[model samples]
Target chain A: MTQGRMGASGAPVVSFENVRKVYGHVKAVDGLTMDLRPGETVAFLGPNGAGKSTSLDMLLDLRKPTSGTIRMFGSDPYHAIKAGRVGAMLQSGGLMPEVTVRELVALVTGFHPRPLPVEQTLKRAGIASFAGQRVDKLSGGQTQRVRFALAIVGECDLIVLDEPTAAMDVETRQAFWVNMKAEVAEGRTLLFATHYLEEADQAADRIIVINKGRLLADGTPSQIKARAGAKRISFRLDRIDEPFLLGLPALVNVEIRHDLVQIQSTDSDRTLYALLDAGYRPREIEVSGVGLEQAFIAITAEDDRDGNGTTPGRSDSAGVASYAQH
Target chain B: MNSTLALARAEVRRLGRNKRYSFFSVGLPVVLYLVIAPSARHYHVYGVAYPAYYMIAMASIGAFSGALTGNAQRISQERKDGWIRQLRLTALPANAYVIAKIIASMVITVPSTVLVLLLGRFYGGVHLELWKWFAIGGTIWIGALAFTALAVAIGYRFMPDTVQPIAMFVYFVMSILGGLWFALSGFLAKIGDVLPTYQVTRIGTDLISNQSVPATAYITILAWFAGFVVLAVIAVRATAETV
Candidate 1:
């Protein structure tokens, strides 16, 4: 998921080496290893039970991983944070109802050696207008933005976020990404976990997928998609026999209902041409690259796939080795 | 601005602005002290001055009020919301957070103690000299730090919803047994002496009565303050580590 520090080569700013965290008997994070580099923005993606939040907690050192090491700026994340190196925003927005945004930022900056100008930090967070508004009066998205502002309100080097935009509308989410891109452009590092595949695709140079407490995939967005393989191909044909289409090479699985035709194919192009050969004039043709959503579903939907769908290699040490060997 | 003073200013603003926090910290203490002081005027346990008795009880009420409210719930909410973690992102040090909490505790405690004393003096038949004010203020300041440590320990160790009940219980028990009249029973004095409230009361009443404080109570109060400071130091470390 994350890379180790690259040394004079510019090592990662955040690294998780075979980290494990358990709540009761439930393994919230299992053998998860990941890295994030300075000026690099990485997206962590997974299903409902995929341990994204737990991994964040471990990375932030709010909850120590039951096993393994997590480092930020090449030190224990919590220790580094105490040393004024890391900033974070959890899923639930953090703002004291009693304090205004300016007050909050001012209060938190008190925890640092060289805090940013309060007004500037508020402007960066887009809550400058609400600087005097108590937190309880702010809307959810505003509160989230305020929380985001507070995180970077410190001049900390690393930013860790869990579901940074879950409450925002599409417009605000985009605005947030644009702001994040600007921050990353400033040579800061970011690690955020989210369920929105589009978010990962847009915000992260690298995407990591976790399923059932373990890492299922980690790479550049295309790399993860490449590993997930070409999973979906949909089209509208003049007319194509379902059985005939299913019989085509790499089209062994096909579903046709009404005017919509869907197929899971290893070689989508091969299947597309065959439909053309069969005198099929389509009203619409669509082919999806193994995007993060496809990658996420493919990586997590294996249990019900029988023997048909692709599954990443199950490596107990596979995830661990990724970090150890690095 | 000085960090502690800034923290205290913000804390006072919080208590004033939020009607709920204000009511709990400001209004409740005044109302309760008013009601409590008037009711206690007629009662005395073992010849204790009812006025001084009420003052001591009300002071602990102030202590619990100040200690329990923002110190824990606010911190917990901030912790839960990722605010503290966000603070870590800033150049802010962890000590500021502890300082802020202590300031908030004092801000809450000061007004609460003042109002309770006013109620005791005006209506509760309590006569207090300037020195008595100084002694009470000094002891209460020490008690504020002690209570803050307890509040933080609870806040860090328990969920917000869960912590309120425990704090309320401590407030109730400390006010009742450790005090004389608002106390559930005067008979509980033997058991009350072990509580910080009782030691604090012993210290306060001694000062108010213009008599020498028992060396034991001063030692106990000092021990109480030291115990809390030690615990708060540990809790602040945990907050930095865990939050």
Candidate 2:
């Protein structure tokens, strides 16, 4: 929707060109390449140790990439940041102690060449209530908000956040996204790394999934679900033809036990219509949507299974089913 | 440049609010001078009256201790807490943090040096020419600046746990061996001759006694300052990725 309005013709806000970061024997980020456009809210989704943090670190120039380059607004990431064109809040980012929240925010705001008013930033971040409180004395959740307050202290085009709501309670998390939506509405690009699948699905316009330091999939929420065999269709049939069933339209995976058959499909309607066209009458037909959580688990589990071929008890579909139940 | 100075100003404000820092860096020196300089009125060392000599020693102690111990510990803790990492995300220049810290340390050291010098003038009764007062204060301030570089080196190189003991060890060794705690003689003075802390005190004493300050004193302090700056640069560079 944003791309339609802004027209994806401008220079990318961020671009990673085959970036690789290696530590001793481990390649933290290996040959990763992606681009984020203007006014886009991109969600970086990855399992633990999937090089998400490493990639973000390299993007912000906190850690040098062993090879490849990251460009922000056609210049290098560091220069773009120093030019006050980007703002970032790392999960490891901490606040200065012994100062009131307002003082800390104001201090950082003064660093930007074009700064937002400190009070406006505080209000926007939902931190105005505790502006007078000392930063070190805040609770874990309150501290997270203050760190977020710091990130938006400056007027920057791109805002990068790493697990921005990790410590927030449910209500605070809701309020956070509300404030965040207002920020993004102002034509700024946002990139956030998150473990919360539903949060990503709800907030992001585009989602990039990575596993084992490699891009597994990159698409919108529905596209990612579709890639993971989005819908499950099951029925009991009097006559079962396993070979023909495998050839069904949009079929991703098929399993048959005696007269009962189960199929995973990207387009359940097309698969169902195709089955009827093939003269198969199935009873007790049940179709269900696999949510983004299951899709995410399936994607990463498939990658893990592919990477480690020997250890095999469960498959991707089964993992999806288990997570779907949860 | 304005942003860096703004950060430095904020740091100075925070330092003012810290009671423990104020007591140790400024108050303790005044109390120590009031207690020690009175008893040593009849004595003399380094070709100047005892109060005059002890005045320099106490001022050096207050300034150097504040520069070394307080800053080292705070920097290490801040680094560990990812405050340095947080600052890097801002538009501020890369070297701004260390520069602001050094600036804050320098600004905070002034009042301590001045207060001790005033006590030496009125309470301790060690009067001096106007230029001499400025010279002595400037010398101690510059010496603390050197120690601030050393603090940055230690802070960037080690964790807070290790910084505490290391800074303490350096503080005590430099203070006693440099004759800041008391006047050294013979072999002790010979060893103290090589130390920047001792050289700083000697420059102040030499200025008061109407003798030309030794070239060795200036060379020793400047050399240490250069070495500490180099060490601090290497430490900051080495930890760039981690921070």
Candidate 3:
């Protein structure tokens, strides 16, 4: 809320302006520029080696950008972190092993000027039962929960989780998100980097896909799906004319095998109507949007094809639509 | 409580929980004293009885070894586990982390120093005045600062697996070279006189014998302490940047 007040003049809660991080010959993060406004639950979706973690490190102030700047709450990342405005759970690694979970959490709580009660933090992180256990003795999932508790104890305005649930079981992951949703309700800006597309599709209001240290796609889930430009309409047709099918409205590509014809269309509704109007009796027709996983692959693959080293996804409508025909 | 003090307290609690630290910081020195002091009790070196001299020697060695290795191992382990990055993400200042380590090392060093002193007084028949006891204990504790810095520098410079062995090797070499094992008399004594470890014991000997400690001893020890501190700062900065 204080961060929101500070952003009254319309500054983003977090911004990266052409930030680049170079490690010798490797450009870990290449000219990354993006912003998260207050209360936006943005997911950083990328494959491994996609610069997601590198970008997160710069945002967390653990690593400095080689060029440009990263601002959190209108100040540098370190200052924001120092002011207790940001909290993070990194992908791997852990707390001090010798101390009990509660003590480690309490120690982190002391680092902040205003922190949530340790009990409440432990409860929210779902580690209250094991709070007395030494950190080194915890299972991988339990250690992650302890780290999550440490992150929330500060009650920071911006919570950055790099694969927060990477080690959790199915049930634990579900419960973690349930608690995460409650935290999000507090209107804090949340940014999480994860390889799990389902997590991004379900948890993020806006998803930014990065690949090879470049932004591949940035939009809402539906927008990204639409940008991917392919919807599937499958049906069993006794007889089909391939040319006629390809000629149908909004049809991009058509595939036929045995009695099954799979239509890849930019607008499945229009394609379906065209199929019906053309007197083709297609039985058991099913329509579905291109899933996030497919979209993610397609987007990154597009970047791979362009290979011209030019920034491709900067323009949302034209850039994505241009690739629709291909 | 301040963040630094809170972190330091946690470090102390960690040291308390660590069985290996307890063994090294308290048990090993006392064991070594018990094993070696009796046979050397009657042998005199440099106008002091060997038991009394060896008592201070074992105390210094144990305290220094514990402080250096303990701090370095903990820091290297933290770095390996990404705890240092976690700390960097918090509001805790970088220097506070270093300072907390120094404090924790000192806290852990105390038990060994005291235990060895008491062992000297009772079993080794070390009959120093009260002021001399205080002075010896105080000198050993202060001398640990150099090792603390050395350990911190090593922690930042090396990986976790190598940190301990490197610290132990440094400690062993310094202890031998500085005459903590036995009193050196010629060129070896000259080399020992220049090292901080030798100066630490020399100052303790001066306290017990009621002799004024030469200014060179203070200068050498302080110089090593300063050099270690600078190395620690540079090493920490280098690791932070590369990380």
Question: TM-scores across all candidates?
Answer: 0.80, 0.92, 0.92
- RMSD per candidate (Å) reads 5.2, 4.7, 3.4
Which parts of model 1 have CA positions greater than 4 angstroms off? A1-9, A110-114, A231-253, A256-261, A270-291, A303-313, A316-326, B1-9, B18-53, B69-91, B94-99, B114-133, B180-186, B219-243
- Model 3 off-target regions past 4 Å? A1-9, A236-259, A275-284, A308-326
lDDT (CA) per prediction: 0.70, 0.89, 0.83
Candidate 2 residue pairs in backbone clash: none
* lDDT ranking, best first: 2, 3, 1
* Alpha-carbon lDDT of model 1: 0.70
Give the per-residue lDDT of model 2 (tens digit) for A1-326.
36622257688889988788899999788777788988999899999999999999988989999999899999998999999988899889888899999999999999998899999999999999999999999998999999998889878899999999999999999999999988888999999999899999999988888777767777778778877799999999987878889889998888899888888898999999999998878999999997899889878887787767674323443343334323
| Candidate 1 per-residue lDDT over residues A40-120, each given as its tens digit | 777888778778877877776667777898877777776787777777787744556667677777776765655788888
Each candidate's B-chain TM-score, in sequence, is 0.85, 0.98, 0.94
**lDDT tens per residue, model 1, B109-220:** 7777787777777777777788778787678667667778777777766667877787778666766776733543445777877777777777777787667877887777
Each prediction's DockQ against the real complex: 0.44, 0.77, 0.73
Q: Report the number of the highest-DockQ candidate.
A: 2
- Backbone collision count in every prediction? 15, 0, 0
